[model samples]
Target chain A: SAVISQKPSRDICQRGTSLTIQCQVDSQVTMMFWYRQQPGQSLTLIATANQGSEATYESGFVIDKFPISRPNLTFSTLTVSNMSPEDSSIYLCSAHLWEADTQYFGPGTRLTVL
Target chain B: EDKVVQSPLSLVVHEGDTVTLNCSYEVTNFRSLLWYKQEKKAPTFLFMLTSSGIEKKSGRLSSILDKKELFSILNITATQTGDSAVYLCAANLYSGAGSYQLTFGKGTKLSVIP
Candidate 1:
């Protein structure tokens, strides 16, 4: 099992500001994913982070808004730029070993933009 | 569009009752299906189903996959108040070798009352 950790578990930010959330895994993983969960809604994949490549984002999400960086196999970060009330949500990170076919998640970063 | 749909968006049940959560999906390349339980924080992985006609069980929770039907079901028996939370279903999309992303359903919110 992999233990994932994220920094600043909870934070309240103001509009037009940016917040970068960090994720670290105990073991090396080829891929790391970032997700956003809005209130009363399910999770939506923000992007997939590769160890040394540009993050691949899902439709309706742009790198300029949610830039991601994965400099190594064990760490990645997601930056929410120019935050707004609509961007207030919980951001989570996950990693896994495919042979195990299971993914473990971090506690998540709860961001409330005012 | 590739998507996952879950039924009974919200349910209120009494303790000791049995409940079944449903998830259907439509994707180009479906690699696997997963179940997760989310309380107030991050989602905890429940089960991962890759093949049909196989049942994965753990305590009061169990799940099965039907690839031909493009759907899956999660069963919770002898439910307790502790089981109240949002049950999520996700579909893994296989884009290429060592590449995948998870698309989630809207989720089923279960509330177990006394």
Candidate 2:
């Protein structure tokens, strides 16, 4: 099991503003991912943060809207750019330990775009 | 596209009662199935099942996976008020690029009344 933390536990941003949420893991992980959870909905994977490489984004999500940066094995950041009211959701960061089947999640950053 | 569906979107029960939640998935390159409990923040890992016909137990919570049926079930006995939370089910799919991602279901919101 890995411990993960996210910055800016909750934030209210104006439309068109951008916010970058940071995720820090207690241990080095082989995989890191960004996920979004809208109100009353399940989580959807936004992208997979690859160390020293461009993130692999899921369908319906683009790099221009949600950019990810994974500089190392223990840290990553997801920036929600040009936010809108529809982008108001809970953003979570998860880390998967090597050979582990389970992924541990951060405390989640709740972003409310007004 | 991977899909995960959970039954009885919401459930209400009295303390000490037992309840069961169901999850079914349709995904490619299936790797594993996981259960999580979400309260106010992030979803916490509960169980990870990689093989079928195996029951994983933790305290009063138990889960079983059926690979052939493409579904799983989580059972809670002697439920408590503290058990009120959203129970999520996710299916892990191998991307074949040395990575795996999860597809989540619209969790079952369980409210345990005292």
**How do the residues B5-92 of candidate 2 rate in per-residue lDDT, one tens digit apiece?**
9998999999999999999999999999999999998999999998899899999999999999999999999999999999999998
In model 1, the clashing pairs are: none
Model 2 / residue B4 / CA error / Å: 0.8
For A1-114, candidate 2 gives per-residue lDDT tens digits of: 888999999999999999999999999887899999999999999999989779999999999999898999999999999999999999999998765777999999999999
TM-score of chain A of 2: 0.97
DockQ of 1: 0.86
Structural similarity of chain A in candidate 1, as TM-score: 0.97
DockQ of each: 0.86, 0.94
Please list the residue runs of candidate 1 whose C-alpha ends up more than 4 Å from where it truly belongs after superposition.
Answer: none
Q: List the residue pairs that clash in candidate 2.
A: none
- Model 1, B1-114: lDDT tens per residue? 898999999999999999999999999888899999999878999999999989999999999999999999999999999999999999988867679888899999999999
